[model samples]
Target: VAEWYALVAAPGAMEAREPLRDLRGALRAMLARVRGGRRDRVGLGRAEPTLRWLRSLSAFTEGEPGEGREPFELPRFWDALDQTFKVTSQEATKLSLAFSRPPLTSAEDCRKLSEDVQNAILAVATVYYWLPKGQGTTLRKMVRDATTEVVKGMIQLTETILSAPLESLSQEQLISTGGVWEACEQVSNLPRDNQAAVASALAACLGVVKDALEEMEHALVEGQDPYSDIVEDEELGFRGNRDTYWSEADRKLLSSCMGLMKASKACLKKVLAVVKAYGKADSPEQIAQLDDLADIANEISPSVDELALSMYPPMNQLAVRLNAAKLASVLKKVLEITKTSHVCPPSEEGWVQFLTGAVDHNMNKIKNFTQGQL
Candidate 1:
C-alpha cells in the first residue's frame, strides 16, 4: 500500500493499486478464516478446472510474451511475493488440518481461503509488471509452479474430504492431508517451475526403480534374500520344511521375476528420458498427460517393492505373480498414456514396443514357472 501510494504521483501507476489493495484485503480475510474456520463440503468437478487452468497458464508462461504483455511495474516484488505465499501457505495448513478434526472445513472458509488464493494469484501475476519487459522465464515459471502447488494442494484436500464419509474420519483423508502439507512445503523448492520439478520427480522414480532392480539382482546373484541376512535353517522333518535355500522352484520363479523387474526398470528409464528431454507441457492436456505418466511410474515402484519383499523364503508364488501382474498392468497403462502424451512420440515408440515385448515375455515366463510348467 505504501509502495503504491508512493508511486501514486507517477503516471499510469494508479491502475495497479486497486488489485494490490484487493489482494491485501483478501489475505486479511483468509487470515481471519484460518484463525477460526468452520466445517465444509465440495465436489470434485470444481477442482479439476483449476488443475486444467494452471496447466494452461503454465504453457502460457512458457510462450513468447507476444502481444499479451501488459505494463505498470512494481518494485521490491519478491518481498511482497514471499509475504503472500506465506499467508497462502498458512491458509492451506489450516484448512487441511481442519479436515483432521470432526466436521470438515466449511465451504465458506474455503471460499475465504480461495479469495486469498486468487489475490495471491494476482499477486504473482504482478511478476509480469515486476520485471521489465521480457520478465525472465524463471520468475514466470516460479509464478506458475507456486500457483499450481497451491491450487493442487487445495484440490487434493477437497477431494479427500469429498470422498471420506462424513460419518467418520478415514485413512485416505489423513494420508491426503499430509500429502497436501508436503506439497505446500515444496513451494519454495520448485527450482525452475513445474517442468523442472516434474523432471526431478521422475528422476526420483527412476532411482526407486533402480533400487528395486538392484535388490532383485542381489537376490539372484547371491542366491539369498536381499532385504534380510539372518538365515533360517530348513526343517529336516515332516512339519513342512522351511528351507533356507532357494527351492529349484524359487530360482526359476525368481529368475523370471528378475527378468520382469529388469524390464520394468528399463521401461521406466526410457520413459524418464523421453519425458525429461522432450515431453511437451505446452497445453493443459499435455501437462495432464505428463502427470499421468508420473503417476503410473510412481505406481510401478510400490508394486516392485511388494514383489521384492514377497520374494523371501516360504515365498508365495501367487503373491509374486499377482505383484508382477499389477506391475505389468501399470506398464501397459503407461503405454496407453504414451500413445497420446509426449512421453512416447512416434520417434520414441519403438523402444516402448521393445520394452512392452520384454514385459510380456518375462511376465509369461513367470506365469509358466508359477504354474509348475518349469
Candidate 2:
C-alpha cells in the first residue's frame, strides 16, 4: 500500500494511470497472498495447535503429582513465572512496535520473534507439570487460571502478527498485544494462598492510606502540592494573583488529622504483621473469617483519605468533624474485628489492646482539633 501510494503521487503519474492502477492491484493481491501464505517454519499463523497443546498440558497436570523435576517453592515459582511473562510480553510488544515505527522488522526477524514468543509461553505451561503436587487445590487453581490468561493473551498477540500489515500496526494488533501485558500484570497480584490474600487486601489499603498521608505531608511539611506543585487547592476553580497559602490554623488541623492517619497506618501495619504470623485458613470457617477481616481492613484507607482531604484550604470544619467521626468508627471497628478474628489469637490480645488504646488516643486528639481545642 505504501509503495502504491508513493508511485501514484510521483510527478506525471497521470500519464501512466493505467500502469499505476495495475501496480496497485498487483500490490494488493500480493499483500493478500503474503497474508494468506503458508504458515512459517515456526508455525506462526497456524497457532491453534500451539495454544491447544499448552492448554492440554495445564489440564494434564491439573491433578498429576510432581515427580520428575525438583519442584520450585510456590513463591519462587510464581515470581519466576511473572518475570518470564513480563519479559516475553515485552519482547512481543517490541516486535509490534518496531514494525509500527520506521525501518520495519523483516519477515525473517518477525518469524524469529514469533518463535521466541511461542517458546516463552510454552515454557510457562510446562512449568506447571514440574510444580509441587502438595499445593492446595485453591492456590493451584488460582495459579492455573492466571497462567491460562497469560497463555491466552500470548497466543492472541502472536497470532495477531501473522495478519499484521507491513505499513503500520493496526488497532486490533495493539489491543491483542496489550492483552498480554495486562494479563502479566495480574500475575503480580496473584496471591499464593488465602492467608496472602488477606494480607494483600490490607497491604493495598495501607498503600492508599500512605499515599494520602504523603500528599498531605508534602503540602504541610514542604509547602508543595505533590499532585500540582504550583496550584493551590483554593485556586483550583479561580486563579488569583495571590500566592498559595496554608494558614497555621489549617496546618494544625491537618497535623492533628495526620496524627490519626499515622495511628491508622501503625494499627494496620501491626495487624498485618500479626496476620502474617498467626493468620490461618486451614478450615472453611477460618478462611471465611480471614476474608471478612480483609474486607474490614480495606475500609480504612478511603476514610483516611476523605478526612485528610477535608483539611485543604478553606477547611470545612463540619466536613472534617464528620469525616473524622467516620474514620474513628472505621479504625475502632477494624481493631474490634482484628481482636476476635483468627488473625488475632489469645496471645496477641494484649498487643491488640495496646494498639487499640493508641488508636483511641489519636482519634481523641483529632476530635479535639476539629472542635477548636488545643
Candidate 3:
C-alpha cells in the first residue's frame, strides 16, 4: 500500500490527491486491525507503535470526524492542496521542455529561449529550496546544475549576438535584438548569488562595445582630421616659398566643402533631435524613430568625412588654412554628437578602423595631388 501510494503521488500522476486520500484511509483501517491484535504476539508487539503513528497522521487526510470542523475549512484545505499540485506540475513541465530543446539558431531566438530557460530555472530553484532538508537532494542538485549550465549558455550567446556588426542590422533589428543589456537584465532576475559573475561580465562587455561605438560614430559623423601632419608640412613649405594663392577651382572646391560642412551640421542637428526624442520615449514609436536616426546618421556619415577630408591641408591646403578654426569646431561638435547618441558598435574593431583609414587615404590623395602641382 505504501508503494502504491508513492507511485500514485509521483509528479506525473493524474488525480494525485484522490488516490492519496484513499491510500491514507486504507492505512487507517490496517492500523486499526493491527492495534486490535494481541499485544503479546512476538512480531506485532514492536510494529504496533509505528502503526499508531500512521493512524495519527491519517486524521490530516480525513479531518477529525464529528469534531465540529467548519464545513468551509475542509474545502479550503483541499483547494490549497490542489493548487499546489497544479503549480508544481506546470513548473516541472516547463523545465523539462526548456532543457529538451535543440540548440538555438539565431540571436533573436537565443534571446527568447534564454529568458524561458532562466524563468524555468528560477521556478525549479524556488521549489527545491522550499523542500525540507534531506528531501529532494538529488533533484535539487540536478536543478542547480541545470541552472548553472543554462546561465552560462545564455551569457555566451548574448555576447556573440552583441558582437555582431551594428551596421549590418537595421535600426529596428538593433532595437529589438537581445545583447548585453538584455542579458544583464535577465541575469539580474536570478538569485543574488548567481548574478554577480554573469552581470559583471555582461557589464564589462557592454562598456567596451559602447566606447568603441562612440568612437566609430564620432569618426563617421564628424570626421577626424588625420592629416594634421600634412597641415604642418604645408605651413613649412609655404612659409617663404610663395604667396598663397586661391584659384577659381580652389575657391569653388572650398565653397563646396564648406557647403557640405554646413549641410552635415544641419543634418547632425536633426539627428540629435531624433536621438533626444528616442531617449525620452519608451514606446514602439520611439523605437521606430531610432531607425530613422540610424538611417540619417548613416546617410550623412560619408558626406561629413568628405567635407573634413576636403579641408585637410594635404588634400586642399588653402581650404584647410582658410577654415582651420571652423573645421576644428565642426570636428569637435561631431565628437560631442557621438558621445551623446548612446549607440554602440554592433560587432568588432576591423570595420571601424577601415572606415577611419579610408577617410585618411582620401586626404593622402589630396596631398599627393598638391605635391604633383608643386
Alpha-carbon lDDT, every model:
0.59, 0.64, 0.36
- Model 3 over residues 1-374: C-alpha lDDT tens digits? 95675464443332212222222232233323223322233233235443453344344333322133333232343344334334433433332233232331334433344334334333333332332212222222333443343333333433333333221333433332333224323322332211122222223333443443344345434533334234334546532212233343444344444543543444344334433433422333433333333433443444444445554333456455334334334434443444344332333223334433433343444444344344
> Per-residue lDDT of 106-136 in model 1, one digit per residue for the tens?
4455456555555444444434334332333
Tens-digit lDDT track of model 2 for 49-162: 444534544443544545445644666777677777777678767756755654545545554655565556556655544554344443454566766777566556544554
TM-score of each candidate structure, all chains considered together:
0.51, 0.54, 0.22
Q: Which residues of candidate 2, in runs, are more than 4 Å off?
A: 1-189, 224-244, 369-374
Best by TM-score: 2
Candidate 2 has a TM-score of 0.54
Report the Cα RMSD per candidate.
Answer: 14.6, 12.1, 26.0
1 or 3: which has the higher TM-score? 1
Off by over 4 Å in 1: 1-188, 191-193, 221-243, 372-374
How far out, in Å, is residue 131 in model 1?
19
